[model samples]
Target chain A: MGKKTNLVGEIIQDPKVKPLSPHLQVYRPQITSVLSITHRMTGVVLSVGSLGLASWIIAGAFGEQVFSVAQLIISYWISQLLLFAWTLCLFYHLLNGIRHLFWDAGKGLEISQVTWSGWFVVSSACVLNIIFWLIAYGFFAKLV
Target chain B: MAREGVSHWWYQRLTAVALAPLTLWFVWSTIQLMGVDLAGFRAWLSGPVNLVLSTLFVCTLFYHMKLGIQVIIEDYVHDHVLNSLGLIATNIVSVVFCVLTVVSIFVIVFGS
Candidate 1:
């Protein structure tokens, strides 16, 4: 049997070569660019995290047996790690969401200031997540 | 002259304004519910105030998420089909999640 033709090869083999649009590698990263990309990434993460919430709710509705199973899974070491990651994603998404709201309001798009603020928001989200986890695990001894 | 961008600006502002209190309440509620057992958690959520506040929070949160995600997809996804699909899927998922949240709240609050 003949080998299947790759789409890219077929397109490239065409006699009429169209000029391609500029790609990501051609452009420098700016604050808005970084924030925009990170926002989408965090949004995707949060979307996945919603599934965890859904599982909890459905388990709660089902009854205690299911809830106990969920509790065991959530309290497991690996699940705890994932939960910590999800919490960081949540905070990052929330902070960047606020930043996007500001930009949507026609503010904070200035090059220098926006860049610094973007960094600040990312850093603050990490720090705040750590503080929250510390309070949860240390003070409360909840380990979550 | 009527400002051309005022509508976009106002809508964004409205969502932001709504999200402020809702987000705060959501965080506060989460913190308060930290260590409660199932029945205890359900009892706390069963209150009229908590149920109502959660309803408001879920609605506002999904609305804000839709608006934010719409802009992101509009800006980044260059392919028309993919962009439209993303936007439609975002709307569908948010609506479904909103409904689920409300239903869960009712189950928690009203269901014995």
Candidate 2:
């Protein structure tokens, strides 16, 4: 028989076959690109953020004097900088998480929609961060 | 077993939904806690409802953390040895973080 339909023959390579879809290697960088990776990075950041919060709680459980020691460190300029960065990460992650929910609901898949949403996410994170710090400073002014 | 992948995926969304409102509440609460000391912090947490919410927050957040980390490691680390070590370490870190925080909260609420 000239069938030539053995299992081994069926498994033979077709090197001529093109990949069905584009991958990371083919894409050019864009707002969506940055936003995409930042989303993952923020997830990592928020995990550390959880640890930071828990550590703060644990420090408080150590009594006032001990808590004050940690507080002293946090009061320093560098710690303030880190806290700001952490805050940005938290807000970015939060906003991006919502963006992801929208994507899950099958919205924003078109190129134009994705780009607009990407910029929206970026601006929202930055604006929200500034507002947060503004309110913090405003509160501090009142505390004086 | 019902598909491992589906359960993992399901938990991700479930925890995400749980986190949404909790995160907003947390941000609000933290801002309000500004300049507050240990006593104030303890007092806020001492409420039964707070105790329950905080526990849920910590548990779900860390569980989600572990799942996220697991997927990242599995995807990026091709080396078998390193891949496994990364996963084990992440698990330990998540477990330890939750355990310590929860225990600390308990101690604050009710000393041994």
Candidate 3:
């Protein structure tokens, strides 16, 4: 019993043992929570995506041979899929960014407004991605 | 350093404000590059205004990006030593990357 008491005491003393705020998995997902997490995630995605942008510019500086080589690699089906995902991330981040601006200016705090904007951001991003790729493969490639 | 947190937040928003329209131009131009070859891309970026705006955009972009991700690292990483290391790494990587990007843009726009 004495050893058990000491063990419990040690556990209680551990800083890592403290109760944490409820994390995402513990709660049923709602629009507010879902969008909040997505915002963080997409921010990370864009950070990595910026590297892709950098590579393109760097390729340009290296002249046609290097640029065309990089372009060829990006022309693969998997690369196109990744590019589409990056495009979705970009549009989502942009709209969500505006949503945040609306927040900073002190509008859209109401639950209804938040929900509406959340849906708007998601739908707009999807629609824009479709339209973008259509133009990409169609007008850009003159294939459609 | 008590004010450091708020300042990071402030600059994040400030850069976002600058980036909004800049991003629009960037996205539009990238779309316009769909069929553009290396020479064509060089010609497009060679314009004085394009070079200037792109330089501004790249700088502001990575600056805002570093600040934003710094918070994520701070929040999620519980180990004290690891958190600081993450931040330092993020800062170094972003600076190096932004420099490379800016240099490349400038070289293409001018040296060509």
Candidate 4:
């Protein structure tokens, strides 16, 4: 019993054993929490997606042959799908990020405003992605 | 430590503000570039305004990326040594990519 008590004491004294703030699992997801986490997730996605952007520029640097190959690769269906998703992530990140800036500026702290803005961000992102891609593929491609 | 934290937050927001418009411009430009040949694309970027804005966008982007990833690493990585290593790696990756992008753009714009 004494040893068990000492073990408990040791565990209590451990810095890492301190109680953590309730994490994601502890809370039912709400729009605020959901959008907050999505912001971070999409930020990470954009970081990775920048690789495609980097590759395109690098290919351009290497001259016509490399640039053509890069263009061909990007034209593939799989690449198009990834590009579409990347743009979605981009628009979401952009709009939500602006919301964050407004919050930082001490506006939109009300829960209703937060929820409304969250929905707006999500919807706008989708619409913008579709419109952006349609014009790129449909309208601009034809002009080219 | 407090000052450093504030500076990090400040720069993150600063870059975000810069990126908002730059992103829109980039998206518009990408749409305009659609189905253009390499020469045509190169010629577009070769424009002085496009060159400057694209360079600024690339630089701001990777710096922001590094800062954001550092925050994630700080949040998730518990080990002191590992967290530092993660930050260093993030910095290295961001710098390398940023340099590669800027240099590539210069080459595309100016190279024969």
Candidate 5:
């Protein structure tokens, strides 16, 4: 067998070598994997969203005319919806990221703890998002 | 390779720690600045504390973002050429965004 095909041929011929671990599709969806992928998804969203942030700042720097243009775009409902999603993504990523930090420190390795923290992260992120929007709209400010 | 991997891991976590508070502060500041005009917003950002924190936030954010996207590309992009290209793109995007942010902040604070 040639160098490239030698290992493949041997692996195919050997019955004793058990099949590799199941593919991602084979696994039943669980909190751990779901949240893991969600973290990546949110990261991607925030990465793309950073472009808007840079654009906003650049407009502000360019002076009032450009800044107002940005503000006008932002006032659109679609832009507002995107901003809402971005903020929610921000909170989700931030919370899940802290969980990751804890995991890196050798904490929260238990299965039960992982599941509990996963739910906690989701709930807290939602709550924080709501509070953020409230504050943005002056809901809290009016009370003070 | 191992040394580089370790350094990457270390920086990702370190920046994550730094970003947590900075992001929260940013959200809070945004709330406070709601409805302010361009001049008012610029004036607020140019203040000493906001300027420093905003600078740190932008730098750390883009660095962290670059590292995260690099991992995603490494994980999913199977072809060697594409993987390398993805990494390059990630680096360029992050650096450009960071520089743009910092320069904008500088111009707002110091430029006429």
Candidate 6:
């Protein structure tokens, strides 16, 4: 069989495949990796949350009836759970974002410190989210 | 290669620094509005302080989102055409959403 020719036909193509470099599979999971993955995950979550914001704006613009319907949906138990999730996502994204900012500024790139701080940020995000939900529910429970 | 210093990093830090308290206030305001009627919610939002906070929250939130999304696209999307398009689209959407959010705040605060 004739060899396949290309625009540059004189060049011989190498038949052997190059060795694939090690990727995510090779490394042990660590806090920095967890936080890095979570940051992107929460970014996506917040993107979805932005749609909720859009809905709120549109409903508010339309009229009271439409707004009330949205209010009803959002106030439901399941929706409240979603809101809590969204709130957590917000805080996580915010904390990790600050971490990224610090890294960008050429600080905290030390292996030990970076991983330690990543865990700290993640833990702080969880604690803050819990406190926020507690306060929100405390106020909300009063109104009910 | 572009210079490797802390300017971009500083901006992100600054944005997060500003957003910290603003986010807390936003969460509080949103919770306060829970179960309140439309009029009640509107009245709260219409108040000058709430309007200002809401405006700031929306603007900062979109700004942060834009910055984060831009970095993500730059890192993962290798194709020059796709990366540029994604960057542009992200900016456009973020700006439009910010404007819409601000406009809605104004309508709530002043339209009534």
Model 1 preserves the real interface contacts to a fraction of 0.18
Candidate 6, B53-83: lDDT as tens digits: 8888888878878877888888899999999
Between the candidate structures 1 and 2, which one is better when assessed by DockQ?
2
Task: Kindly report which residue stretches of model 5 are placed more than 4 angstroms away from their true locations once superposed.
Answer: A1-20, A142-144
TM-scores for the candidates: 0.75, 0.84, 0.89, 0.89, 0.90, 0.79
Q: Can you write out model 2's per-residue Cα lDDT over B1-112, one digit (the tens) per residue?
A: 2578999988988888888888877777777677677788788889898888888888988998999988888888999999999999999999999999898888877762
lDDT of 4 by residue, B1-112 (tens): 4568989999999999999999999999988887677899888998999999999999999999999999999998999999999999999999999999999999888888
Error of 6 at B35 (Å): 2.1
Q: Residue-wise lDDT of candidate 3 within A13-32, one digit each (tens)?
A: 45556767867578998988
lDDT (Cα atoms) of all candidates against the true structure: 0.73, 0.83, 0.88, 0.91, 0.91, 0.80
True contacts kept of 4: 0.73
Clashes of each: 0, 0, 0, 0, 0, 0
Better of 1 and 4 by lDDT: 4
DockQ of predictions, in order shown: 0.31, 0.55, 0.73, 0.75, 0.73, 0.51
Best by TM-score: 5
Report how large a share of the reference interface contacts model 6 reproduces. 0.45
User: Ten residues in a row with the worst lDDT in model 1 chain A?
Assistant: A8-17
Query: For model 4, what is the alpha-carbon lDDT of residue A119?
Result: 97
Q: Each candidate's interface RMSD, rounded to one decimal?
A: 2.7, 1.2, 1.1, 0.9, 1.0, 2.1
lDDT (Cα, tens digit) per residue for candidate 5, span B1-112: 3568888989999999999999999988888776567888888998899999999999999999999999999899999999999999999889988999899999988889
Highest DockQ: give the candidate number.
4
- Error in Å for residue B75 of model 1: 5.3
Where's the lowest-lDDT run of ten residues in candidate 5 chain A?
A2-11
